[model samples]
Target: MPETTIKGPVLVTGGTGFLGSHMVDALLEQGVAVRCLVRKTSNLRWLPEDKIELAYGEITDRASLDRAMVGIKSVVHSAAITMTEDHDEYYRVNETGTKDLVKAAMNHAPDLDRFLLVSSLTAAGPTSRDYARTEEDREEPTSLYGKSKLAGERALQKINPPFDWTIVRPGAIYGPRDPALMKLYGMVEKGSVVRVRGPSQLVSLIHVSDLVEGLIEALTNPIAVGKLYHQAHPEPITWDDVADYCAEALGKRTTKISVPRTLLPAVAKGAGLWASINRRQNPLAKDRLDDLLQ
Candidate 1:
């Protein structure tokens, strides 16, 4: 198939983030003019120094979004916070921020061909079976992050004078630049015993490259419009197996140690408390203990 000509520049929010940076690279490689909207405080080391446009804006500010949308025909709404102590912060950035972008896209880029929202597999909640999740499943997010994303998805659907919208819910995305996965890799590299909170629980995952490909495909494919898609690498690996993969990647043996499920709550609770007291954010909050066991 001939490549779809992106008639105008492409706008990428959260362009300094892990997945967003990859998406920016992918768009640039496709010979598409990329415009990145990022906060003033965001680190731009991952982004190229040339060949793209930059717009300083935060998701919370609706007024500045119009500047980013100018001359952009495709909007990849990747701006979102994954972890936060306040649930309201998640809603503000993930839901309200998304709504603002969609509205801005409609007003500024009236002829926009696509608006892609990068979401997460957590939107589907924790599944009992090991099978890969599909787009048809009901969204029952188990965490504030997931819940806020689902809310964003719902808000996007209600946009007036609608543009083509595709929601891609990716599983645990892992790659070189991923902060969370890198921590696991670091632990394994240090020969630390990796504890498996739930040894038998299976979770889906995708490489950052694969996910970027999916996002680009969704942008041009009419089938993706007004649809939600779940993405993985066609395989689901357990948490224990993930540690083993990291060990193998690092040329080390897996230090598999099973932590009892009963103790996970206490551990998570303590971690949460420590994070709270330190005014730090912990992704592994108490609510995650149950999902960890699955």
Candidate 2:
């Protein structure tokens, strides 16, 4: 396929974040001008300060979104709250914020080529290796995060913008700059790995690099417009498989300790309570636990 010509700079929301930062790097390597939409307080450690233009703003703020959309050819919307104690925050940022962004683009970026949404597999709900999911399947999100993302997808469809729009739903993503997966690797490095006893849990994951390439294609490819795509490895891997890989990579002999499934809710609840009290995210929140066990 011939390369799609992008005229103006591509505007990326959440460019300072893990996935977004990787996207920025890829775009820069392709010699496309990049602009990042970021909050005033967002950390710039991951972003290439000297390379990309920074557009200061929050996605929820219409005015800021408008300012960011000016003269931009395409948008990569990767800004959404992944973990928060408040359930409303998911809708506020993911659903409503997305709606606001598309509205801004429609009003401001008359020449916009495309708007690409970085969504999650959770939005499509649970699936097994036996029954893989397809875009044709009904989205039955199991968590608030998933529901919000699905809602975000709907928001784009509802607006029916003249410009192209695509949604890429990636499964459990793990790579550099992902602190959550790092914790598991850390545990494995310590010579002990924890697992939930019962049925083997399966997950589809794609490396950040591969996912980024798909995202860029979804953004630039005219055929992908108005379509939703699932991006992940073809085969699913179990949590045990992941732990074993981590152990082997670190050259460490690790012990696998299984925890009772029945006790997880309590532990998750405690973690949620503790995180809530301390104004932090609960990595093992009940909603996330539901996703794991589902």
Candidate 3:
């Protein structure tokens, strides 16, 4: 497919999120006009206000999505809840919300050129260190979040929309302003890391800049239409690799300790119980504990 002229703004969902905010920056830096679909309650601290339009909306609402899709040339759906004890919420937001957005774009944006979905490697589960997961592999999602992401993909595929579309699944994205890695960086600054010596699975990592580049590529490249790509550094890394780099970056001597696997179940249960009592998310919920090992 030859590239069409970009005649309208690119609408981005979750523009205030860490990854979404980076996407916003990349779009603006490249001279594309951006319109963000944002809720009134969303934080704009990570988002820049200049040269951008804000369209108040929610993914689950058709009317709001309709307003956001007006004069939109393309859409980048990047919103999803990462932590939730209720499995239904994942399906509601990731899967159902995507269906609504795709429908709105199809119904509202007559000249839409691209519709890119920023999924995650968790949707494909994991592989041994010897074999990196590829787009050709059959998906075997091991977590609720992964299943919801896969569901989102399936929801769009079911529509069979008449437009250029692609999917990019990224792994463990880390960079400046990302809070997920900050805790580990803080621990490294204090001179220690907790290592779980168990199954020792392979994991992939990508920088925010590289992943944002991949996102733009998937939109502009004709070869990406109806295709799936896994974007990551060309290698798999282990926890030891992460620890050493963190320590090196912080210039601190760090102690690494091996923790017993038996200790996790109790911790997970205790955390789950406390969360249920307080209506808060457990950092060590069973799924999260499984995530730490798997």
Candidate 4:
């Protein structure tokens, strides 16, 4: 993090995602050349084509990853999916995908030194309202996605490839061009706010810039190697706090509604059933909803 501790030509797996695009820009700003791995049909509007090299690959496909691994010295794996009703899909992408990527790195990119895995705070599960979660905490993930991410971390640790690997767990990353925050702000614009009630009274949030800085630290800091770090703002912000802030900023009174916690599991199940009957993606899987409640 201290003025170019990491070298150039880094490969980012999820270049098209909101956070991934911010990372690409941050790396490029430091004069580190970046290569983005994305599918053929991926939208390139977030970043310009001239600033980065493109490697067409999917994490589920080993051969494609192998092709992308060539000549890449450091890897910042940011590719992941957050939406879907199926646990199998989450396992396949978040868990198995990480395994395949690490395997490919071991087999193909022998020269690769710094491997950074971008995980989530959900992997650590919920903490008491007054406590801050730490890396030493045992992983009791609330959602299937969290479980898969924790599994990925375990896989990387077990593999223990001949390289300096670091795992980073970020919390509630929000910033420009983020759709979820946009929706929240839009709700604020309309003088309405909604959030799920949870067991924990506090929430952790880190802006995209701060999250990207932590990621760069993971890449450059020698102490970060072989360690797991939780990268989140120290301050705690709750759902009500977010709503109140938006309302105060916009000079409008806000109507805040907290959904009843008891209905979440049933709603999730009903949504799953509806999705199956309609052959569509479920908005919230039961496991995910349960995680939210926690």
Candidate 5:
């Protein structure tokens, strides 16, 4: 790790989230003081309150963000709503919230050394070309979530600021404590046969630990400033391999049943309906199924 003068305290917007918490841990390991901006209702169970400064705020509230950005030299903007009560809420939180943060950061911390945006690979859209997508590829987001995230990336680029900005687009991030991968883990643990849709689909992924290192590298590296980088493990694994690995990790047999592409839409619709009736969010929403099928 490159050493630097303690310019000012770093602020992480979603410091309590899985990725955000891991980033915070990495920053603390580097002996950097962190100030976390979290909403009043957001869960803070993963964070150590005594060791870091806590700023009570929400991304949707500009005034709250303005207050949080004070004395902060750098920011890791990660407070995005993945699943929401309403579909349009994704745009409100992901796109508009990002613009608000960029404006606030420029206003309060114009001399900020680094502004790292934790964006998803989904922003680059679907790829059936059997290759890992790079930063040079054109963004053709297929879903509302992807479009919103891509919009946020565009918003950040359009910002007129003097600070160094880097966008880290991470592929499907998975590791211990990842709620997004919990459903797959549960299925593997229950000895349930996993169904692979588009078994030949090649997708890139990165362990959360490796992703943290990439984020830290982008913080001060001049090559990363004003550039978008795709962060993933060197190997791109097939969907079937992902299932097999998860099963092997859980000490279970991977009896993979391949689901036909034609039947996926119906299955996803049924899953969505079941989740709606049960008042629970389904990870296998239509867009997610589409992503898998692609």
Candidate 6:
């Protein structure tokens, strides 16, 4: 598709989310017309209703997706179930929902310029000792969430839709409104930092701002079509580094506490049990713990 044909509003899924909200703000800053596919029950505090259009819908509903795609020239698929108590919910929402969204685009958005899938580093799983993963990596998703995300990617690949498409796997994202890192900050403020007992675990991380910029580039840059890219900070860091930064930022002294890896399974199991009993998502559920350990 020609760049000129991509002039219509860009449709963003998950626009109400942490990362997606930043994506919408960035696109608005660039003077791009933006349309958000949001659930009627979604919180619209992050979205400026006067600036962008809202198409009330859920990703799993094909009819809603079709309605959202009307006059849409591009799509940024950022909506997904990241943390849920139900295992099958991951497959239903992340994998099957993604397939439904893609099919909607194929059926409705005839002039679609780009379809960008926002995935996670978990989709590629862990890398070998001292080695970083590349685009050619053999994905070995350790958790159901990771597996579901990989299945979503396959939805695009196996279907091979007519429209140009790109996939971007972003590393752990941290920025304002991110609750994931708030635990670390809280721990640091309490004069303690926690880590698992093991060899130094290296992980990729990117600020939400940088990740959003990369996603926008991948969606707009012609070279990104039919390509997969890993978006993360160039340097890898350990949990200690993150804690140290948090301590420094807070101007506080902190002590490091390392829990034995042997205790992880018990902790995860307990968390899972509690979640099941309460019918609520647990922060340290087994599957999420597996992803965290990696």
Give Cα-based local distance difference scores for all models. Answer: 0.81, 0.88, 0.85, 0.84, 0.81, 0.88
Expressed as tens digits, the lDDT of each residue in 1-294 for candidate 2 is 845665459999989888999989989888989999998999999998899999999988999999999999989999988887678999999999999999999999998988899999999998876888888999888989899999999989988899888999999888999887889888987899888998779988899989998987786777887899999998888888988888888898999889999899889889988988888789887777788777
Where is the poorest 10-residue window by lDDT in model 3?
A: 1-10
* TM-score per candidate: 0.90, 0.96, 0.92, 0.91, 0.90, 0.93
How big is the positional error of residue 138 in model 5, measured in Å on the Cα after superposition?
Answer: 1.7
- lDDT string for model 4 (82-181, tens) is 7686668888888888989998888888788799999999999976676777888777887888888898888899899898899999988888988777
Per-residue lDDT of 156 in model 5? 91
Candidate 6 lDDT, 1-294, residue by residue in tens? 623233458999999999999999988888889999999989998999999999998988889999999878889999999887789999998999899999998998999889999999899997655788888979988999999999999998999999999999998899997877887889888998778987757778999989988887787778888999998988778877888888999999999889999998898788878888988678797788778777
How many steric overlaps are in each model, in order? Answer: 1, 0, 0, 0, 0, 0
Candidate 5 vs candidate 6, lDDT winner: 6
Clashing pairs in 2: none
lDDT of 3 by residue, 1-294 (tens): 646333358999989999999999988877889999999988899888877999998887789999899889989999887777777888899999999999998899999989999988889987666788789999998888888999999988899899878988999899988886898898888888887767555678999999998898787878889998899999888877887898988888999877778887886788889988998777776664565467
- Ranking the candidates on lDDT from highest down gives 2, 6, 3, 4, 5, 1
Worst 10 residues of 2 by lDDT: 1-10
TM-score of 1: 0.90
Give the Å error, residue 151, model 5.
Answer: 0.8
Per-residue accuracy of model 1 over 1-294 as CA lDDT, tens digit each: 634655448999988989999999999888998999987888998999588899998889988898888778898888887766566888999999999988888888877988889988887777666455578877677777778888888888876447778898998888968998978887898787547555467888899999998888888877777888988877787777788777887898755666776776787778888888888777666544444554
What is the RMSD of candidate 2? 1.4
Among these predicted structures, which one has the highest TM-score? 2
